[model samples]
Target: MMPMVLDWFIGNETCETIKTKSSDDVCQGDSTCYNVDNGSGYRCKCLDGYQGDPYLPNGCQDIDECKDPNLNKCEKICENTKGNYTCLCPKGYHGDGRTDGTGCVANQSGGSLIIELTVGLGIGITVLIAGSTWSYWAFKKWKLIKLKHKFFRQNGGLMLQQELSRRDSSTETAKIFSSEELETATNNYDESRIIGRGGYGTVYKGTLSDGRTVAIKKSQVVDESQIDQFINEVVVLSQINHRNVVKLLGCCLETEVPLLVYEFITNGTLFEHIHNKNKASSLTFETRLRIAAETAGVLSYLHSSASIPIIHRDVKSTNILLDDSYTAKVSDFGASRLVPLDQAGISTVVQGTLGYLDPEYLQTSQLTEKSDVYSFGVVLLELLTGQKALCFERLEEDRNLAMYFISALKEDRLVQILEKCVVDGAKIEMVEEIGSLARRCLRVKGEERPTMKEVAMELEGLRMMLEHHPWVNNDESRLEETEYLLGEASLKIGSNGGMNNVTYDSITDHIILQVGHGR
Candidate 1:
């Protein structure tokens, strides 16, 4: 078919055309133009690395190739002029950066030697730094391990191991724990794990890898002079097996001050039960009597049953702990003394709670089994009256509960000073008997106080009597009978003076009125 024709009218003429020329028909030499196809126009374009319109004179000029990374193949440096680009080697390089020549090469003499020396020095410095860091870390790790070993040896680890080896294999042995094991157990000795603190140390609660909960007692101060004594105590405690005494399961000696681990008791201390208002109400007369009996039994065993006679120098309610079942577990032997078979008493520093301290032992600086008996007597007073052994809250004359108890008994006012729970729960006769027994124990002379075994037997008998004869009465005649049974010898006043003004009749009247108001 013939191409379509277009007609145009100029000022004075008319024309008809069947064809038209486009720029694409005249494009040349590294320049190009594309036809519009619609017949309106065409466009011109230069090849890569060149810029300008291809239809104009000198329009397709050479581009400065150095400005673009893709167009330049220089190894070191590139330069550009008005219409061309050049690749040149940088200083210290021998060859031209061109396609026909070596791109870049090191100088033959001094420059190449300098480059080699610089690279070698850099590698040496890197290796030296790496070796130094590795050596430093290795030395630190070795020093730490050596320090731990030294501590283990210094804290009597070898002695403890030998002692354990000498014991019977059938019996449970006290474990020697590593510092890491205990640290992991107690979360690195976290403050939250602290269960108790005292003059000796802090006690932390820990759960071992074996899932057993334990109480770890860490000493606050270390006396190098007492290392022998400390190890001896460990040996003695490990050999002891009693239900009333807290069990020493293991020890960690790598610490600055040695740590002792015991089976954890869920319930708090006996002092807490006796002193805390909320917990006091729960300690009924029966529970208190039972606790007293158990504590006495433990002291008796320490005095007589153990292979060595151990005098518990600090025997107060706080040292006695209770489990979930309220069973007694005597702890804290930091001040205990081991007595020889022939020695009657150990003369040493007077160390004990002020209120429960034996006046004779305090004056003479002599510790004995009777000193423990005296302390136990004060604990009995605590149970009967729910009063602290030494409470400044009371009137000046009645600050010391032991002295106050003796004064009350001497004036026949025991019923007035006794705990309300004890009054309501126990027979007046049993209370009187316990009071007389306690009076005998608080004698100023250690020799005058009954033996721990004797005290334990008396408490046990009272417990058995209360359990078997629960229906016993609290009649006035029985009260008189109990008072007479005490005898003048058991009630004899010691150097510790008594209160004179308080009478039983007046205190009884006051208590009767108080009881009446309560009802």
Candidate 2:
């Protein structure tokens, strides 16, 4: 057994085989502990950072921390005794704590000299503190300048300037704004000046030196590699000029991200009126249809009439701004793609907001004009239902409004799915016509969707019908006139279920029910 234990210790026998050896255990003295085999015995020293052999009686005593100057962080004077130390301020200062200093030396004399010295030292300390704070602020300001310069370069400020220079005569000049000018205009970029914020960046409401109210869009930071894309966007935006599309007034490139200036639309986004809790009740069906038509017209212009066909990758309600009178101003071209006339489509990474993204473009990454059509479909649905493009309250697979709408159509339960706002007896024929238009727009295949021009025409037709046949409060004669103006007086809305859905025909009913319901 001793020979086998020696063999095991010398590695001649395996550890597993030597486990049952009763004489294999070994022990060391009080200060040290050991595990022994014949020749492979080793010992461990007590931990330095800690103390004591873990197995010994009372273990080991802690090292005198005060004895080691390196472990002490005493600011001024450290006097070591045994296991602890005393801290003292230097001769000029007087304090007991390690990091503290009692004012300067306490005055000993009642003389004017002592008073003068105290005043001078107090003033000196105040000045020093103020200077240090100023220096820190100056350092931060300098760092911000350098960081903004780096971002400007990263966002292709140089390329944009070059592009502007090349087309200075033919194109409307693109302004290169300074940070100081923008900061002054926006009152140091105060939150009160913030008009909008979204995936692109925050927008500030600014009154320029020239007294023009403008919407300033600060682009989000981009990686250095995306500088080319940034320059491309600037170039494309500079060329855009449509009455309905938000006008690009200028830009500021001195900031880390480029800041775009646009003509301010005071009424805010179309989404606000259609869905915002404070404003939705004021939006009539006629206004919704008119806004839809105007939006479609702007989109059609972008798709076909722009110098280069621009596919507005994002075409949700939020992107559509409204002037004081609610005239639609299509905006936010951050995700817009300029499709070249020579190319049929662009194969690029999918980019667009989730609810508004084209299913075909999302799946295949082949972006075309029809991708805009799909997004416009969502917008149409929003206008029709006064609900969001995506809602969790809906069924799992039908969570998306487009899918839910299509499902509603398939089941022929259109009136049930539409908001109560639109359900107050819209003519079955009129509702069917609008629903069919929405269905065509929401076609699974892009090619099957109508051209933006056709969509605009259809929406215009809908608008004209609503304008002539305004939903009334009381007079049956006026209702008859509305029917006559619609060009077809035969269409009826309600089923024969005694639940006759009809427009309010009395002034009292109009006041009670509020805004006119059917368009």
Tell me, by TM-score, which candidate is best. Answer: 1
By summed lDDT, which 10 consecutive residues of candidate 2 come out lowest? 505-514
lDDT of 2 at 182: 88
List where candidate 1 sits over 4 angstroms from the true fold. Answer: 1-140, 471-519
Clashes of 2: 7
Cα lDDT tens digits for candidate 1, 304-418:
8888899988999999999988999999887888988899998887788889999999999988999999999999999999889999998889899998998888898999999
For candidate 2, lDDT tens digit of each residue in 70-165?
Answer: 766566667663335567565445455454444234334555567778999999999999999999999999998998787667667888888878
- What candidate 2 gets wrong by more than 4 Å, as runs, is 1-149, 168-171, 420-426, 465-519
Residue 28, model 2: Cα distance from true site in angstroms: 99
Using all chains and alpha carbons, the TM-scores for the candidates as numbered come to: 0.68, 0.64
Candidate 1 least-lDDT 10 residues: 510-519
Model 2, CA-based lDDT: 0.71
Q: How accurate is candidate 1 locally (lDDT)?
A: 0.79
